[model samples]
Target: MFISFEGIDGSGKSTQARMLADALREAGHDVVLTREPGGSPGAEEIRRLVLEGDPDRWSAETEILLFTAARRDHLERVIEPALASGKVVICDRFADSTRMYQGLSRGDLRAVVDQLHSLMIKREPDLTILIDIDPATGLSRAKGRQGTEERFEDFGLGLQEKMRAGFLALSKEFAPRFRVIDGARDPQRVAQDVLETVQAELPG
Candidate 1:
């Protein structure tokens, strides 16, 4: 199975992704836990370029290209191989992130993002878990970590709010494979919900 987690910077999707991978592995599922912008070695290099530096380092259009390039490398080198070998691939973030961050944050470049995805990537997770939360709380949580990848977090609460709405909209648009989960609860509680949701969809 292929799965991707999506949400604003501090929505705990990454934590949930890790929890899911670990849980599945414990159950004897072969799993690959990864993240976008930096999954494979080549993509990891691209990750630093786009994720660090100033928030204004790259415009939306420029970011779209950079992210796509990274994603292509990741898909080719990591995601596809794991999936083909029957391992569950749990990814921290995926193209939907690009759709919101680079597509909506700076302008309406969603079409551009979609076009590139269809042309280059042409793959979507069998399921997507969107951990939805309030922008203020999400940003607070994100900033609390104080990691170096603060480029998006530094965009302020305004961008986080917009990204939250955008992700919710994407869930509806991709309803069949999208699962929306409330992420405002305690981490363990949230992981329980995530695990249940994923379990239901696991192959019988």
Candidate 2:
């Protein structure tokens, strides 16, 4: 199975992704926990370029290219091999992030983003768990982890609000493969809910 966990910065999707991978492993399943923008070595180099620079270092179009390049490398090098080995791939973020970040909510290039995705990478996760949370709360949590990859969080609360709405809309648009989970609760509670939801879908 291939799963992707997505949400705004500090929504605890990363934590849940890790927890889910660990849980699956404990159940004797072969699992590979990975993340977008840097899942493979080549993608990691690209990740540094897009994530570490100044906020205005790249134009909307340029940023989309960088993200797509990184994603393609990740899928080809890391994700495909693990999935071929029958390992459950749990990724912290995936293409939906590019669709949200570069596709109008954060940037102004929705059409270009869609075109690039279709022309290059056109795959979706089997299941996507969106850890939904309020923008203010998520921003506060993100503030505590500011570092080199702070560009997205630096987008401010207003943009985050818009991104939240965009993600919610995406969940509806991709309802067959999307699972929206409340992320405002405690981490353990959120993890429990995430595990249960994912478990129900797993083949026993």
Candidate 3:
């Protein structure tokens, strides 16, 4: 199973992704936990360029292409091999993130989506879990965490709101493959929701 978790910063996707992988392992399944833009070494370097660099350095189109490049590396090096081994691959984020962050915020949805589709014909996740949260609250949570702000994380609330809306719109368009979870809830509750969703989606 290939599952990707999506959400704004501070939405606890990383935490829950780990938790889900642990649970799956306990259930006797082989699992690989990873994150986008930085799963493999080359991709990690690309991640720093894309996320930590000056926001003004890259145009929206450039940002989208860079992300897709990182994803291509990640898929070739990590995601595909693990899936071929019959392991569950739980990724922190995937193509949906680019659609939300660049497409919605930058006002070039079709171009970004088309480019991504061209690069990654097998890019779609089997199950996508979008953790929904208010941008203000989510930002506050992010502030409490220990890390320098990435370019995308530094985007304003308006952009994050638009990104959230974009995720919702995509979820509506792909109901069978998307699961939108409430991130405002307690972590355990949110994890439970994700667990249920994954259980329903994964084959026996």
Candidate maximizing lDDT = 1
Per-residue lDDT over 1-204 for candidate 2, one digit per residue giving the tens place of the 0 to 100 score: 899999998899999999998888898999989998899999999889888867788877888999999989998888989989888999999989988988866557788888988888888899999999999999999888867788877778988898899999999989999999999998989999999999999866
Candidate 1's error at 66, in angstroms?
0.7
Candidate 1 vs candidate 2: the lDDT winner is 1
Per-residue lDDT of candidate 3, residues 1-204 (tens digit): 999999888888888999899888888889999998789999999988877757677888878888888888999999999999999999999988887777778776756566676757456899999899998888778867757546766776777777777888989987888888998989999988888889888898
For model 2, name the residue pairs that clash.
none
Query: Which rank order by lDDT, best down to worst?
Result: 1, 2, 3
Note the Cα lDDT for every prediction shown: 0.94, 0.89, 0.84
Choose the strongest candidate by TM-score.
Answer: 1
TM for candidate 1 is: 0.98
In what order do the candidates fall by TM-score, top score first?
A: 1, 2, 3
Error of 2 at 146 (Å): 3.0
Tell me how many clashing residue pairs each candidate has: 0, 0, 0
Regions of model 3 farther than 4 Å from truth:
none
Q: How close to the true structure is residue 204 of candidate 3, measured as C-alpha lDDT?
A: 88
| Residue pairs in candidate 3 whose N, alpha carbon or C atoms collide under 3 angstroms | none
